[model samples]
Target chain A: QGGVAIAECAACHGEDGIGKDVEIPNLAGQHEVYLYRQLQHFKSGKRSHKEMRFESRQLSDADMQALAHYYSQLPR
Target chain B: QGGVAIAECAACHGEDGIGKDVEIPNLAGQHEVYLYRQLQHFKSGKRSHKEMRFESRQLSDADMQALAHYYSQLPR
Candidate 1:
């Protein structure tokens, strides 16, 4: 499920959870809850990253949680 | 300089760069540029978190960069 959810994320945040660019954040080993909350914030407009907001809007609560867990487990 | 800048941060983001609470983000091994950009966003009100905004207001550009480097170097 996480692998499927993160298909789009791999473009900017690589398969290893390392970001493709300096401006992008590395998700590897980040706090799971924090990642989930940031996704929620993006969906609600509390966090203002245009692409993230659009991407997060496509996720369900379960999808977000799974994606956060998947990334948090990756080596930093 | 990074050590000095991270004094207050150690309270919430621990000395090891792991967050003390679930709501806080772990900074260990995060991309330096991304961390620096987030700090700038907090200071400029582009990102909204009450405590972070207040804390970031106290930093200069050099301080932010040093703090970013400091946390990014910690083991995740």
Candidate 2:
């Protein structure tokens, strides 16, 4: 992910994208396109969750793409 | 899973739990606990996506459990 730090994601999604909480999704090995799209939705307000929207809104397209690539590559 | 009529779910999430849109997550074979928790979150406003919130709010706890079980059993 181009060396960007995404520590915030680890709080809920865990360090490996296997989400820490049962309510959260395990992002590991999910489709990269799907990851990117969901981030876009959260950023655009098409999808709205308090924490996710806040986090995603701060992401640039590059950040979103990088995170998507990062998570999609992880083992579930 | 017990013939509770969840036709509304088939719109974004297809008949087989494979989401029709690239942005949506495929729910097939996802964790039952995870699915159930998310449905609860959507139902309770802990998470919010317009359509999801609207639909989930209409579901009873039994409906959430049934839907979760149904999706978790499908092939991803």
lDDT (tens digit, per residue) of candidate 2 on B1-76 = 4354467797788768877876677787677898998888788876676888898888888889998989878865
lDDT of 2 by residue, A1-76 (tens): 5244378887788777777766787777677898998888788876677898999977889999999989878764
Model 2 misplacement above 4 A: A2-21, A29-34, A37-60, A72-76, B1-4
DockQ of each: 0.83, 0.37
Chain B TM-score for the candidates in order: 0.95, 0.91
lDDT of 1 by residue, A1-76 (tens): 7567698998899889888998888888788999999999999999999999999999999999999999889987
TM-score of chain B for predicted candidate 1: 0.95
Tens digit of per-residue lDDT, candidate 1, span B1-76 = 7566688999999988889998898888888899999999999999999999999999999999999999888876
Query: Model 1, stretches more than 4 Å misplaced?
Result: none
Local distance difference test scores for all models: 0.90, 0.79
Query: Residue B70 lDDT in model 2?
Result: 90
Interface RMSD of each: 1.0, 3.2
* Leading candidate by DockQ: 1
